[model samples]
Structures are given as C-alpha cells and as structure tokens.
Target: MDSADANIATELETRLSIIDTIERDDPSRRELSGADLSLFIGVSVVIVLFGILVLAL
Candidate 1:
C-alpha cells in the first residue's frame, strides 16, 4: 500500500511538471503587455474616482 501511494505521488508530480512546462512554452499564454497594463490602470483609476464621487454625494 505504501509503495503504491509513493508511485501515485511520483506519477502525479511528473504529470504536473509536464503540464507546467507545456504551459510555459505555450505562446497563447502571455504576460500583460504595455497597452494592456495601461488600459487596466486607466480603468481602475476611473472606477476609483467614480466611487469616491459617489461617496461624496
């Protein structure tokens, strides 16, 4: 039973490592670009300002 459990754990780790490597290599999985970051920040600032305005009124 212990050996079986160990084998399962090892297999799981191996599969997870393969998945991680594939995901890292995938071109579609990209980090935020400069335009994306700017848009996000602009939207966030607008939302915050709107919230503050609502609270004031």
Candidate 2:
C-alpha cells in the first residue's frame, strides 16, 4: 500500500481505540449520566452527518 493509505488506516485505528476506551465504564474516565449520554449520542450523530455533507460537496 502507498504511504497515504497506510496513514489513513493508522488514523482510523487510533480513533477506534479511543472510542473503545471512552465507552468503558471506568471510574477514572468519563462516566456520563443518562442525560449526558443522550446528548452525546445526539452530538455524535450530528457530527457524522456533517462529515458526510462535507464529503459529498
């Protein structure tokens, strides 16, 4: 694979690992309440949709 392809793969792996860590219920990390979690879900969806819009443009 080319250098650009390798770089993109590495960045995606890093993001997935970070998400996995955040999703865990560890006390040391963020422990979102139900309301906060709902807000987060809404925000994440918004960001994803925005990204798709940018890509399409």
Candidate 3:
C-alpha cells in the first residue's frame, strides 16, 4: 500500500509539473502590456489596409 501511494504521488507530481510548464509557455496565458496591445492593433490595421489596397488594385 505504501509503494502504491508513492507511485501515485510521483505520477501526480509529474503531471502537475508538466501542466505548469505548459501553462507558463502558453502565449495566451500572458497579459499584454498597453504598448504591446497598441502595437498589435496598429499592425493588424496596417495589414488590413494593405490587403484592401491590393484588392482594389
């Protein structure tokens, strides 16, 4: 019973660590600063405008 408990604890710890790593690495998990958010929006607008211009031509 002790061995089985140890094995379960180890497995749970491993899984939790992996999940923590994945969450840390995930881009969407991050909060965007105001400057970063502004830059992203600006770039998106520019790209959309460029696409429209190209389509018009």
Candidate 4:
C-alpha cells in the first residue's frame, strides 16, 4: 500500500538522520560529561540486576 511505503520511507529517513548526527562531531554541540557517565553506569547496573533476577527466577 502507498501508506505503508510512505511510512517505511519516513522511518528510513529518520534513522539516516540519526546516524548522520552521531557521525558528525560538532564542537558547538554539547559534549559528554560526568553526569552522562554516571547515568550510563547506573543503567548498566540496573540491567545487570534485572538479568540476575531473571536467571534466579
């Protein structure tokens, strides 16, 4: 269907834009900081805990 095709195209465009944004490192954009690191570590810990709980169950 035409609508489905359009939806696929839009999703592809969005993914491409995200990839481009990540690949292009502009100094004007905010750089990663300590808070980002802390958040990443916290999320990692949560994921590990959830995995352990699932295995225990």
Candidate 5:
C-alpha cells in the first residue's frame, strides 16, 4: 500500500524481467552436459595414466 513498497515491487519486477530476457536470449548459457563431463573426466584420467607410465619408464 505504501509508496516505498510499490517502488520496491516495481524494481524487483524490472530486474526479474531483465533476468528472464537474458536467460532467454543469451547464448553463453549454452553449456556442455553430463556426457561432456564424463568424456572430460575420461580424457583427464587417460592423460594422467599416460604421464605416470612415462615417468615410470
């Protein structure tokens, strides 16, 4: 009912709208999924094992 509360509500709505717009429009939000993480972990493990083998020889 108060002007202060109304101002806060308006500001919040605006910020939320901006966040929605950004999430809807931004491409950087595109991300690798679980399969990518699994492949990365597998590759890292292989590299570490190869390094260990090289060091042991």
Candidate 6:
C-alpha cells in the first residue's frame, strides 16, 4: 500500500484502540440508594440557590 493508505490504516487502528479502552473502563450500570439520590438533589438545589444569590448581588 502507499504511504497515505498506510497512514489512514494506522489512524483507524489508533482510534479503535482508544474506543475499546474507554468502553472497558466505563461503568456498565449505575445504582443509587434513596439517601444518595436525596443528597445529590439537595446539593444541586443549594448550588443553584448560591448561583442565584451571587447573580443578584
């Protein structure tokens, strides 16, 4: 194959390898308990309120 064709093949192989690595590292599923959900929402609300207060200043 030509130099350009070889470069393209190499690029494709690099990209596919990166994708495989990411898929392997990523979580398959997520599970949260009631307290975890509540805390997340509570923190989110507090952040939003703080942002609004800062903007009002």
Q: Which candidate is the best by TM-score?
A: 5
List, residue by residue over 1-57, the lDDT tens digit for candidate 5. Answer: 799999999999998898788776577666788998999999999999999999999
Query: Candidates' lDDT values, in order?
Result: 0.90, 0.87, 0.90, 0.87, 0.89, 0.86
> Against the correct fold, how does model 2 do in TM-score?
0.42
Candidate 2 residue 1 Cα shift, in angstroms, is 54
Clash count per candidate:
0, 0, 0, 0, 0, 0
Residue-wise C-alpha lDDT for candidate 4, range 1-57, written one tens digit per residue: 599999999999997897678745655555778999899999999999999999999
lDDT tens digits, residue span 13-37, model 3? 9988976887776776677889999
Give lDDT tens digits, candidate 6, residues 1-57.
999999999999997887677655556534576998999999999999999999999
Q: Ranking under TM-score, best-scoring first? A: 5, 1, 3, 4, 6, 2
Give per-residue CA lDDT, model 2, range 1-57, as digits (tens).
999999999999988897778746656566668998899999999999999999999
TM for candidate 1 is 0.49
* 33: Cα error in model 1, Å: 0.8
Range of the 10 consecutive residues with the lowest summed lDDT in candidate 5? 22-31
- For each candidate, give its TM-score against the true structure: 0.49, 0.42, 0.46, 0.46, 0.52, 0.45
Compose the digit string of candidate 1's lDDT tens values, residues 1-57.
Answer: 699999999999998887689777676667879999999999999999999999999
Q: Which stretches of candidate 5 lie over 4 Å from their true place?
A: 1-16
Error of 6 at 46 (Å): 0.4
- Model 2 has a clash total of 0
If both were scored by TM-score, which would come out higher, candidate 1 or candidate 6?
1
